[model samples]
Target: MTRDLLSPAHTGCLQDFSSRYTRTCRLDAEQVQSLLYVLGTTLKANLNRSAPPKTKYFSVKCTDNVQYIISPLPQASSYLSPVRLKDNSVLLITMKEASTQENDNKLSVWYYAANKKVLDKAILHLTAVDISLDVDADRDGFVEKNNPNKNAWKWGPRGHGAVVLVNCDSETLYRRKPDYKRERILKSSDVKDMSPMVLRTKGPPKLPEGYKLVLHISQSDGENIRVFITSGERYPLVLNSEVLSKEIPYLGTDEIMFYVEGVSFPDKDFDGLVHINLSLLEPIGEGIPETPIFTDTVVFRVAPWIMTPNTLEPVEVFVCSTKDNYKFLSSMQSLVDRCGYKLNICYEYMNRGDRWMQDELEFGYIDSPHHSFPVVLDSPRNGKLDDFPYDVLLGPDFGYVTRVPSRKDVSSLDSFGNLEVSPPVTVNGKHYPLGRIIIGVAFPTASKGRNMTKMVQNFLWAQTVQEPIALYSDWLEVGHVDEFMSFVPAKDRKGFRLLLASPDAGYKLFKNLQNDGHGDAMLFEEIPDQDSISVNEILDDKQLQAENNYVQSCIDWNRDVLKRELGLDDEDIIDLPILFKLLEYRGQYRAAAYYPDMVNLIVLGRNLGIPKPFGPQVNGVCALEQEMVSLMGNLGLTCTFIDDFASYHKLLGEVHCGSNVRRAPFDFKWWNIEM
Candidate 1:
């Protein structure tokens, strides 16, 4: 700061040259080594506060090691040019010669007073530091130096931003909690999940007495993320709130490495983008608090969890072996073996008689440039299988996530069977390379029907990769979308087909059987407890026909929704011959499978595990099986009828409802999609 001296006799204002105070400036080593360095800047502040200073002539005087630097001149002028300091001007200086080691430097200047006869000089102190903050914002796998846009995010192939993976995967099975839930990294693999940040500093072995560098995160970001600095044995967590920040002394010749791990996922509450900052604080006065002279920043966005569809490659199939489902388990084992995929069976000990494995969890995986792994999305429906995912499936590279709403909101619609995904689709020119998620909810106009819990829906919607579309499933007694609709692989036309259970198809198949003189072929003729009904008897039941008409209307409403939302054509659908019967639930009528729901089947590669539909036997084989084979035969699919008649269908579910599958993730990278 400079002050003026004015007297009536002199009638002139005091200029900065009249002051004896010295100006000291510090430049980083990188800046000093450049062709030109900005030593200081001058600008007009407020005209109302103070008048602008007049341009003053100046002469530079400095040590031999450093000199006033300027842009290269034209060939016409090689002589030293006169220097002047004015409003909105930059004083450029640089090292006289390049040097690898630290250099003690100084620069001085003399300026003429208003009298034009007197001269005064001021000393300018100079120093250089090797402080460079770096991050992989460009995603080129190498840390870039001091980029101005490091703290911002950009999308697409040419964008720039660091990536952070949700530390959702586990590295150890000995621990009961997930790896993300642990306070510290459990193994070397856990460290691989974080983004690398480097603070490269080189100077004297120690910083000047009162200078230090501190790393920190904002308070809001601190809650959803954690940062660690690599030391000897332990990577000390810096953003642990107890300290909230960590100070790095002069690294001398070493670099400080920091790893950022996302503790929370992208949801309604968190936006998925996080920031980490580094500041250089300087000591001004002995007792004065240090001031932050320089700051650097880097940003990251948590990767969204992605769901795999049935059309993708199958990794494995999971089913619970209950007390009454032995026949179903055997059928599933044969189907899995024939398909050449692994089978994971949860026996009675852990399942505790809860047979609906599809209701318990959905399989998804989070991904980033650093790492990716399968993360099981546990549903709010807390059946006896609640502990199965957390206890068994969570180990090594596997991850776990769950949303538990209030018990009052929990319903059958909250089950994972209510959750499904279409194959990759392009709706309205917008492509979904990973496919879109499907969920069951009450009809939009209905006020008293059941819907999937809001908390679970929020969690699913936050996974922006595969945006979800809701279908009406409250018409069914169990309120699951899978009870009426599914997806399977196909050779052509979008690579998959939307399968829907059609009561019209069921009646048409039966009428053909009756016309073929198979009317006496009884439905449930020899089945254990079902009363036999002739095809003619079924055709004469006007009330049954009326209920089926109502059920067909419900199915058609969803059929239109699926066609519109998934960009499906009429040719893309396969209507299976399955019928539903309405029953009184509470005060409203909801439909349940009249026989085994053939559409609620598991699709593994080209193999299908359909629930055995106990229909009228016109020949040695069941007519329903023959009809299903005919429908799927054109697609080069094989049908394996799983006899879940008493174990699953009688209990108001079918094959897909009781079994779950974990398929391989898409080969496409999720981050490349334009959001």
Candidate 2:
């Protein structure tokens, strides 16, 4: 719509009534610049008398749907009277309503000087067209027309904007590949995993000649997301179709749909909010390209992958069955069967004998109001079982995502065993509904120390919902966070305990045994295949004691960091009796667990799978196992010990390293969390 320029009160007409002119225009209901605006400016210029034009004024007369705007609005507020016009000013007009039929509305304007009044008169025959582009901007299943909040996103129940899911899941089990890896849709079922966007138009059942609609995304968005359109005939938007940005002709239909799929997850460089634009392009002719007359935009945010904490219910547990792990597998089977959760066993053929299940991948899920699915994060630490996550886990409703780094950048720190998530906690007033992520890295000053690659770290940090915190683990030979600490659910307080391995506790336990005439008692006494050492010999080794002291200092450093980051007090933590032995490597020494690392245990609701630390017998029972039971009993947890000594303990990994769990997603939707 154009503003009606009114002239100063005039006494007489300057031009003859014979100066009448008429024109026709096609006006878009949502156009930013109206057709009448051009008509008004051209009408004044053609008068051919600039000096006399300094005295021209104009007024408009039209129906309720037509509005004429005037600057320094006329005091009379009535178009019946002439309003003054300033030099170098423009005459503008606008259509307020979408006409039901062609030329169903009319508008008229008169130009006058003083009271010579009418200098020139123009009549416009108008055809109004309506264009509405939409998406599930409110996150509801159905698309609503041009929502006011579509252009932006907000929070809370009143917030709006569509939620997009990263199409990382593999729909085809036969030839496995992530659905988003392809530029075009491969299966109809894949469509269900993406968000829907639509373009709707109505007016005269056809658009004006040379006018068209176009859908486009920003260059940055092209790398993160893709949009697909569906056409009924001729050129059906199908396989190998391009979706970056293209002209979409008016098909004389009321609606056209486009599906938005996230091809990449959020990262440090991307905040996850993406915009898709629809424009109505008008042909300017003379071999020139069309210009957009009106643009409608909607925003979408890629849903972050959320990590489930141990506090959540477990649905399934995954572990590999190698020839040497029969006893470990038997113990795991008993524990899982008793807990009533499903257990998946990867046989030698699938695993190829590699059994570090937890190091190969981490389990998490991405969610939206429209859909949700579990996504396995594959690690860069490619082991013999590297194919397990993609081959067996990437099925319908299941997804697989990974980050690859140069092999030189990969180390033991790159393993998923270094990855863990804490239970929900409130630090100050902020709450982490899904808890925060925990990963191992080198101490800041260790120039040559091993650390998780930046690619994986950025991906984890980009998740946003579970902000990740790095803990120093390079002091340990394996460089995995799980080797020294883990979380277990509790019935009270913070709802979980931060179990840490403590060498101090280990020495205290050994001293008590030596004082009770158990100095002759030996460690690993039951295992005939291994050498045993008496408790007195361990107490007398000053070198071993010094090594443990150094290990304690390292564990202490991380304990303080976790306390401050997780908002924990001493009572929120549990110190387990565990020891470490130092190994020399290239003129430097690193600590490794001397016994099965008991802190590296799997939590399954009330039941726990702990490594059986085979310490010397105390009154016909393993004193180390009894100590664990006594400490865990106060929290009402049942500790079931699994013997992984010969199989995994000697290999420097523990039960948690050999097993993985897929827990149920939180009942609380992630969208509600404060970002």
Best by TM-score: 2
RMSD of 2: 6.3
lDDT of 2 by residue, 1-675 (tens): 333333332212222111222222332222222232211111232211222343467655666544443444455664466656554343334444455655556665556787646665555555555566787777767888877678788765567878889989988876788888865566778877888887776656666667777778778888788777765422133212245677775654377877888878899899899988877777888799988766777899899988888889999999999999999999999999999999999999999989999999999999888889999999999999998999999988898899998998999999999999999988877788789999999999998999999999999999888889899999989999999999998999999999999999999999999898898878898886899988899899999999999999999999998998899999999999998999988977898999888999999999999999888787888888989999999899999999999999999899999999999998887767765
User: Which regions of candidate 1 are displaced past 4 Å?
Assistant: 1-55, 60-79, 92-103, 113-118, 140-149
RMSD each, Å: 7.4, 6.3
Residue-wise lDDT of candidate 1 within 1-675, one digit each (tens)?
Answer: 332222112222223122221222432212221111111211111111121134254445566545443222212232233333344333334443322343356554444444433244444454555566678887766678765567898876667788777776678878667766777776766778777888876555665567778887778788777888788767867775455677875666678888888877788888788888787777887989987656667888888888989888889899999888888899899889888999999989999999999999999887766567898999888999999999999877788888879999999999989999888999989988889999999988998889998998887788788899999999999998899998888999899989999999999998999899998877776578878788888888888889999999999999999999999999999998887889996789999988899899999989999988878987777899998998898888999998898898889989998888898888787767776
lDDT value for candidate 2?
A: 0.79
Q: What's the TM for model 2? A: 0.89
Highest lDDT against the true fold, candidate: 2
Candidate 1 CA-lDDT value? 0.76
TM-score against native, each model: 0.88, 0.89
- In candidate 2, position 298 carries an lDDT of 86
Error of 2 at 260 (Å): 0.6
